[model samples]
Target: MITLDLIGIGSGNPDHVTAQAAKAMDRADLILVPLKGEDKADLAGLRYRIIESCVTNPATHVQGFDLPVRDPATPDYLARVSDWHDAIALAWEAAIRPHLRPEVPLKVALLVWGDPSLYDSSLRIAERLAKRLPLTLRVTPGITAIQALCAAHAIPLNGLGAPVTITTGRALRETGWPAGSDTVVILLDAGGAFGTLDPTGISIWWGAYVGMEEEILISGPLAEVASQILETRSSARAAHGWIMDIYLMRREPALP
Candidate 1:
């Protein structure tokens, strides 16, 4: 039987890793890190640094494998994502099976970005692996970019008992702002999806690289800072080769 632990390492900051996640990493016989090509090499490097900093167990081995790319031509978003996840599961199996030995206990781990429960798909991929072999799965939670964003700004997630809607940039762009939500938190934005919404009566808090030293934050009325954010995001991505960001938009209540 193989024990698989999907540990959340939080954002790019090593300090965001939880004690439980660190312990799990130390306990694993093998830690698998996925390389997502040159554009995202820093992501894999961050995982390596976390392992180097936290894993004290000399017995644990670290391995890197190339992640599979999703098929862009599939047209259907859900189908494309599902197919990509299936490919990733196959890749995990191919990488993991070689390290397993007969008649010996094995514990393998994958360091995931943010908490697995959030928008991450590590848990789903692990489920696919579990179906193919005798595998026990465990997950250790870590801070999400949302938490880091809020922390960096020192702001409460929700305002005065109002409901907060968490969604993706695609949803925001496609559907516009959700009804009855005083605040909306967006993730996985390819670019400036906020431009789709009218900036009137809305306040936006935006951050790129929320927890790391290269973090940038901008906030105010959406109308004033929308263009500034687009410019900043473009420059930051150019400087860092990549950027991970999240933003929250709050719509003020109508005056009676």
Candidate 2:
């Protein structure tokens, strides 16, 4: 049996790590860090920095493994994702099994980016592993990108006494913005999902590389800033090789 501690490391900032997450890192026998290829090497490096900052125990070993890419050839998106998760589960099991002992429980940890519940596959991958292994899992929450976005821009997440709908860029493109809600937050956007929406009368607060040193923020009526955001996003992504961004939108009437 293995004890898995899944800790949310927040975005790219080491300070976002919780005290519990820091303690978990010191307690784990093995910490697995996934390498998201050369374009996103900064991600792996950020995790290393977090470990270096929080962990002082030299006994706990950290290991890095190449992440398996999802097969683009799989015609069905849902099926393709299922297959990809299975592959990751296999890799995770292989990485930790050799270090496990039959008599003593092994502590294996994965540092997840942002909150594990939002736009993250670590929870899903962990569920897949549960079916094959007898494991006890513990989750330590950290600041989410949404919170970071709001904090960086100094704006409230929702309208006064109103609900905020949180959805992905893919959903915004497919279903349009949800009805009956004045505020919405979009995450995991590839680029320019705002162009798909009705820019008129809508206000947007967009942040790229939020909570990091390279952070950029833009705000205005969507109509005025949409083009600027699109161009800036493209240029930023090209220059940095990758970008992680999120945005908040609210209809007119100015939430107070």
Candidate 3:
């Protein structure tokens, strides 16, 4: 049996790691890190740095495994993601099985970018692995990009008891703005989803690489800064080969 601890390390900053998360890392028998290709090698490097800072137990083994690229040829979005998750699960088993002992229960940990309960999919991948291995899963909460974005911009998440909507870039591009929630937080934007919106009477707070040394923040009327964000995002991605960003949008008449 494997006691799988999926610890949320938070957006690229070692200081964002909670005490609870550090303790979990220190106690792990083995830690698995995913290598996401050279384009996003910085993400993997950050995980290694965090592990170095927290994993005091010399017995804790660290392992890196290549992440399988999703099949872009798969037409249906849902089908593509499902197939990708399946491949990742297989990759995980191949990485961990070598160190497993039939007689002993293993404590394996993976450092997640943000809270797994949020937009992240590590939890879902773990579920697939559980089907093949005897596993007990535990999640350690850490600051999410939403929290980090708001913190970076020094703004409240919601407007006076109003609800908040959290969605991915694909959904925001396809569905338009959701009703009811005045504040919307967007993640996993491959590009500018905001370009699809009307940008009327809307304000945006945007952050890229929040909590990291390369962090950038831009906030203003969506109408005013949309072009700026698109330009900046392109330049940053070109410079680093990859970029991760999150942004919040709300109706005008700014909340107090």
TM-score versus the correct structure, for each prediction: 0.98, 0.96, 0.97
| Native RMSD of candidate 2 (Å) | 1.9
lDDT tens readout by residue for model 2, 1-256: 7899999888777888999999999998899999989999988899999998988888899999989999999998789989999999999988887897778888889999888888788889999898888899899887899999999989999888999999989889989988879899999788888788878789999999988889999998999999899888999999999988899999875457
Q: How well does candidate 3 score on lDDT at residue 164?
A: 93
lDDT of each: 0.93, 0.90, 0.93
lDDT of 1 at 174: 90
TM match of model 3 to true structure: 0.97
Write candidate 3's Cα lDDT for 123-199 as tens digits. Answer: 99999999999899999999998899999999999998789999989999899998777799999999899999999
- Clash totals for all models, in order? 0, 0, 0
Worst 10 residues of 3 by lDDT: 247-256
Q: Quote the lDDT for 81 in model 2.
A: 89
lDDT score of residue 17 within candidate 1: 93
Error of 1 at 120 (Å): 0.5
